[model samples]
Target chain A: MSIWEYANPKKFMQTSGLLLPWVTGLAAIALVVGLIWGFFFTPADYRQGATVKIIFLHVPAALMAINGWLMMLVASLIWLIRRHHVSALSAKAAAPIGMTMTLIALVTGAIWGQPMWGTWWAWDPRLTSFMILFLFYLGYIALWHAIEDPDTAADLTSVLCMVGSVFAILSRYAVLFWNQGLHQGASLSMDKTQHISNVFWFPLIVCMGGFVLLFVALLLLRTRTEIRARRLQALLLRERMA
Target chain B: MLPELGKYAATVLGAYALAILLIVGLVVLSLRQATRMRDRLRDVEERVKE
Candidate 1:
C-alpha cells in the first residue's frame, strides 16, 4: 500500500506499537556496547588523552541534534501540504528530544573543549550556529505550548521550522563557511583522507547507530502519546456537547 | 575496574554523567507522559461507552 496510508492515526499507532519494542531493544544494545567499547577498550589519544572518549557522546548527540530538526522540518512540511495530524504531532514529538540532544552536544563539547582549546566557550562559527540551533528548538517548543489550538500551533511552528532550517543548515556547514573556528573539521566524513582512523571510528559508528535508533524509538512513543491526548480531548468535547 | 583517565578524569566523567542524566530524564518523562495519557484516554473511552 502507499506510504500515506500510515498517515492515518490508527494505522500509524498499530505499526509503531509493533516496532517500538524491537527498536528500543536494539538501541539499548548498541548504546551499551558502543559506550563500553569507547570508554574502556579504546586507546587514548596521544595529545587529547582520555578527553577523546567524550567524542563518543558528543559527536553522536550533535549529529542527532541536527538530524532531529531535519526530521521535524520534513514532518512539518508534510503537515503543511497534506494536512495530516500525525505529521504535525510527529514534529511536535521530536522537538524535546532534539533539544535534549543539542544540550548534550553543547555540554559535552564544552567539557571536551576546556582541555583541548583551553577554554569552555567560544563564539566560533560552528559553535555559534549550534547555539542558534538550540535557541530555535527552544522557540519551536515554546510556540507549541503557548498556542491553545493544535492546528494553529502546527501551522505557526511549521513556518518557524522552515525559517529555522536555514540556521540548522548553517550549523552543519559553518566550518566550511569560516575556516578560523576553534572547532576542528568533521569527525566522520565521506572523504577517505579526512576520515577518523578505524581504531576509534568503529565504535563511533555504533554509537551513532544507537543514537539514531533511540531517536526513532522516542519519536514513536511520543507521537503515540500525542495522538492519545488528542483523542482524549475530542472525546471530552463530545461529552460536553452531548 | 575503570580506565585511568589521567588528569581529565573529572572532565570525562562529568560529561558522561551529565549526558546520561539528561537522557535518562528525557526517557522517564516520556514514559510517564505516555502512561498517563493512555490511562486518561482509556477512562474517557470507558465513560463514553457507559
Candidate 2:
C-alpha cells in the first residue's frame, strides 16, 4: 500500500507488469494524435513557416531533458538516505533515457535554429548551459558503468546527481538568467500568452504527457532488469562460495 | 515542405531519421538485454531449486 511496500521486488514487479500495458497504450495514442495535430492541424507560424512545427517535439523533449535530471536527483537522494536498492537502480536506469532525450532536443533545436537564426550553433547562455547539462548526464552514466562495486557506484552516483541538479536548474532557467539570442519565449505557459495556437497546444500537451509516461515505463523496465541481474550475480556468488 | 528549400529538407529529414533509428536500436537492445537477464535469473533459480 505504501511506497515502502513496493520496495519489495515481488510487489514492484507485479505492479509494474500491471501498469506497463496501460502506459504503452496511452503513449501510443498520444504520440499519434500529437504528431497528426502538430503536422497538419496547427497553422504554420507567420514568420517561421512549416519548420516551426518542429517546436512541438523539440519543446517537449527539451522540457523532459531537464525534468529527467530532476527525477534522477530525487531518486538518488532517496537511495542515499534510505539505502533503498530500487531507488539507486532506478536512478541508474533513467540516465540513458535522459541522455537520449537531451540529444534529441539539442539536435532538433539546432535544426530549427538554422532556418530562423541563420546559425546552427550559438554561444548563448541557454545553449551553453544545456550543453553542460548534457555533459553531466554523460558523466553520471559513465560513473555508474565504470564502478565495479555496486555500493560504491550507488554512493558516488548519488553525489553526482546532487551536483548535477544545480546545473540542471541553471540550464532550465538560462534564458531568464541572461538575455537570450534567437530562442523565443516559452511555447506554452501558465498565463496562456499563446505563442502557439490551440490546435498545436492540445496535441503538444498530449505528446509531452506521452513522453513522460514512456520515460516512466522505460525506467521501470530497466530497473526491474537491473534487479534481476543483481539477483543472478548474487546466486552465482553463492554457488561459487558453496 | 519547403519548395525552394529542398536541400535543407534532406538535412532535416536525415537528422530525424537518424534520431528515430537510434531510438529503435536502443529499444531493441534494452529489450533484448532485459529478456536475456530474466532468462539467466530463471536458470539460476531453477538450478538452486534442483
Candidate 3:
C-alpha cells in the first residue's frame, strides 16, 4: 500500500498492529545493545573516568527530547492549517514520550554533573533552557486534559506549541550562544569541521538512530490509541443523542 | 557486589538503577494506557453494533 493510504485511521491502526511487535522488539534489542556496548566495550574517558559513560543515555535522550518537540510543533502547524485530525492527535500522542525523554535527560544529566561538575544542579543556560522545555511539555499535556472540546484543545495547544518552540531551539544552542559553561562544547554540531574519533562517534550515531526508531514506534502506538479514544467518544455521544 | 560501591559507586549504581526503574515504569504505564484505550474503544464499538 502507498504511504498515504495509512493516513486513514483504520488503515493506520492495521499498519500499526503489524508494525508494533517489530518496533517493540527492535527497541528492546537496540537499547540493550547500546547500553552494553556503551558500558562494557567503550573505553572510559581518561579524565571523566567511568562517569562519562552517562553520555550514551544522556546525549541520545536529550537529542530526542528536543527533536520530539520539533515534531509536535510541525504536526501542530499542519493540523491547524489543514484541520487534520490525525495530525493533531499525533502531536498529542508525542507529548508524554517527549516529556519522559526530557525527564530522562534531566535526571541523567544531574547524575553525570554531580561527579564531574561537583554539583547536582546549576543554572547554566543548557540546563536552564531544558528545564523550561520540560515545563512546556507539562503545560501541553495539561492543556490536553483540561479542555473538554477536542477541536478547541487542538487549536489552542497547536498555537502554544508554535510559541513554545523557541525555547526548545534555545535549549539546544544555548551553550554555543554564551561563552561561559562547565558543559563541554557540542560534540556534534552543524559545522562539522571538527571531527570526533570513530570509536566514540560511530556507536553514538547507531544509538541515535536506534533512538529515532524507538521514538517513531512509540509515537505511532500512542497516536493509534488516541484515535481509538476519539472514536469511542464520538460513538458514546451519538448514542446519547439517539 | 563490587568493593568500591561502598563509597562513590553507591551513587553511580543508585543513579543507573533509578533511571532503569523509571524507564521501566514509563513503558509499563504507556502500554497500560494504550491497551485500555484500545479495549474501551472496541467495547464501545461492539455495543453500538448490538
Most lDDT-accurate candidate? 1
Give the fraction of reference interface contacts each candidate recovers. 0.94, 0.32, 0.39
TM-scores for every candidate against the unseen true structure? 0.99, 0.93, 0.92
Clashes of each: 0, 0, 0
lDDT leaderboard ranking: 1, 3, 2
Off by over 4 Å in 3: A1-5, A189-196, B1-8
Q: What's the lDDT for residue A217 in model 1?
A: 97
Best by DockQ: 1
Per-residue lDDT of model 3, residues B1-50, tens digit only: 23222234655566667667767777788789889997898888889999
lDDT per residue (tens digit) for residues B1-50 in model 2: 53332335554565556556656675677788889999999999999989
| Interface residue Cα RMSD of candidate 2 after superposition | 3.2
Clashing pairs in 2: none
Winner on DockQ between 1 and 2 is: 1
Which candidate model has the greater TM-score, 1 or 2? 1
Model 1 regions lying over 4 Å from their true place: none
Residue-level lDDT tens digits of model 2 in A1-242? 58897777788889888997788678778777776666657665577766766766787778888999999999899888888888888899898888888888889888878877898889877777788889999999999989999999999999999998988898787776577555665677777775567767788888788778778878887888988988998999999999
Candidate 2: regions farther than 4 A off? B1-8
lDDT of 1 by residue, A34-141 (tens): 999999988889989999999999999999999999999999999999999999999999999999999999999999999899999999999999999999999999
TM-score of 1: 0.99
Candidate 3: how close is chain B to the reference, as a TM-score?
Answer: 0.80
